[model samples]
Target: MWDAHMHCHFSGDSDASPESMIASAMDKNLAGICFTDHLDYDYPNEPDAFLLDFESYEKKILSLQQEYDGIFPVNMGIEVGLQPHIADQNRQAVEAHPFDFVIGSSHTCDRLDPYYPSFYEGRTEEAAYRRYFESILENIDTPVDFDVYGHLDYVVRYGPNKNQNYSYEKYADVIDEILIRLIRRDKGIEVNTAGFKYGLCAPNPCPQIIRRYRELGGEILTIGADAHQPEHVGYAFDQIPALLKDCGFNYYTVFTARVPVFYKLPD
Candidate 1:
C-alpha cells in the first residue's frame, strides 16, 4: 500500500530531504508515496511561515521522478494548514500547482499552536480539545479542494501528555458533524498511523471515530503514515489495513489529480 501523507525539508518542521523520504519508502517496498509539504498561510507568530515553494518544489519532484522512473510512483502533494477566512488564498495556492492531492489540516486552533505547552494552559483539556474540533468544523465549512482532512484528531497526539484517555463518545456531536459534512461534500478522512509513533496506541483519529464515519455512510477513508523523516516512512502501516477492515471499511483510498482510487482490504 501507499503512505499517502508525509513531510520533507520543504515542510518547515521536517529535516529530511524529499529524496531521502523517497529512498526510504522504496526500501520499505511501498507501492507509492506522496510529498505533502506544509502550507499554512498567515500562521500566527511564524515569521517564515509554513508556505511551500511551489515552483521549486514541483521542479525538484519532477526531476526526481525522472531519475526514479518505473521504480515506484512519487506523487506530488501538498498539506495545507486550513484557515477559514483565507479559503480563497488556500484554493489559489493549490490550483496554481500541479499537485495530485491536497490535505486540509488545522495546526493552529483558535489562533494558538496546540503543539506548544501554552495551548493547554489556562484551560481544561476538555475545553482545548473541543475548541480544536470546532475549528475543523469551521475550516471545512466551505468545500476545500482537498482530497481528505489530515489526521482528524491531531490535537490529541501532541497534548503536553500523550492523550491516552480521550474518547470519541465524548465529542460525538462535533465529530459527527465533521464526518457528515465530508461525506456530503464527497471528501474523506485519513487514518494517520503517525499516532502510534507519537505514543498513542491508536491512529490520529482513534478507532472509534473511524467506525462512526463508516456507520454514518462515510466511505472515503485513506491510510497514511504521516512520516517526517526517512526511517518513519510508512511507520505503523502494517497494522492499519486490519484496523480499516474492522472499522467497516472494505477498501482504503489514494489520489491522483485530486481524484480518489480505492484499493480493497486484504482478506
Candidate 2:
C-alpha cells in the first residue's frame, strides 16, 4: 500500500524530516509514498505558519529521490487548505507547483479553526458540525485546484465530544451534496487513518461515507495515514484493505503527476 498523505519538517506543524518519514515507510514495506506537506495559506492566527518554502522543500525532495531511486518511489504532493475567499490563491499555488497529488482540505470554518476549543464555544456540536460541512460545500463550489478532498470529517476530530454524537445519517443531506459534487467534478476523497489516531475508531468520513460515495458512482478513492512522524507513517494501513472491501471498493488509487493510477486491493 502507499501512504499518500504525509508531512515533514516542511509542514510547519511537523518536525519530521522527509528522509526519516520515507525510511519509516520503507520499514513498513509500503509500495510507495507521497509527501503531502502543508501549504495552508492564511491559517488562523498564524497566517504564515503552514506556508511551504517550495524552493528548499523541492530541493530536499529531489535530492532524496535521487538517493532512493529504484529503492522506493517518493512522490511529491501537497495539501492545500481550501476556503471560499482564497480559492484563486489556492489555484495559483497548485498551478505554480508540479506536485503529483493535491489534497484540498477545509481547515477552518468561517476563518475559525475548529482545532481550538474556542471554535466550539457557545455553539451546539450539531450546529458546529453543520457549519463545517457547509463550508466544505462552498469551498468545492469554487475553482480550487485539488485532486482529492482530504479528511471529509476532520472537524469532528476536534469537536467537544469528537465523533460520539456524529453520524453520516445525521448530516446526510449536505454530505450527499458534497459527495455528488465531488463525483461530478471528477474529484476523489481520501480515507484518512488519522481519525483512528484521534480516537475515532474509524477513518475520517468513516466507512458510512465511503460506502455512500461508492453508491453515488464515485470511483476514485485514496487511502492515507495523514502521518506527520516516522512511527505514524502507514499507521493502521493494515486495516484498510478489509475496510475498503466492506465499502464496495476492490481497488485503491494513487496519483502520479496528477493522474490517477488504480491498483487492485490485495487479497
Give all candidates' CA lDDT scores.
0.88, 0.94
Model 2: per-residue lDDT, tens digit, 130-152?
Answer: 99999999999989879999999
Candidate 2 Cα errors over 4 Å, as ranges = none
Please give each candidate's TM-score. Answer: 0.96, 0.99
Off by over 4 Å in 1: none
Distance from true location, Cα of 67 in model 2, Å? 1.7
Residue 144 in model 1: shift from native, Å? Answer: 2.9
Angstrom error at residue 42, model 1 = 1.1
Judge candidate 1 against the unseen true structure and give its global Cα lDDT, from 0 to 1. Answer: 0.88
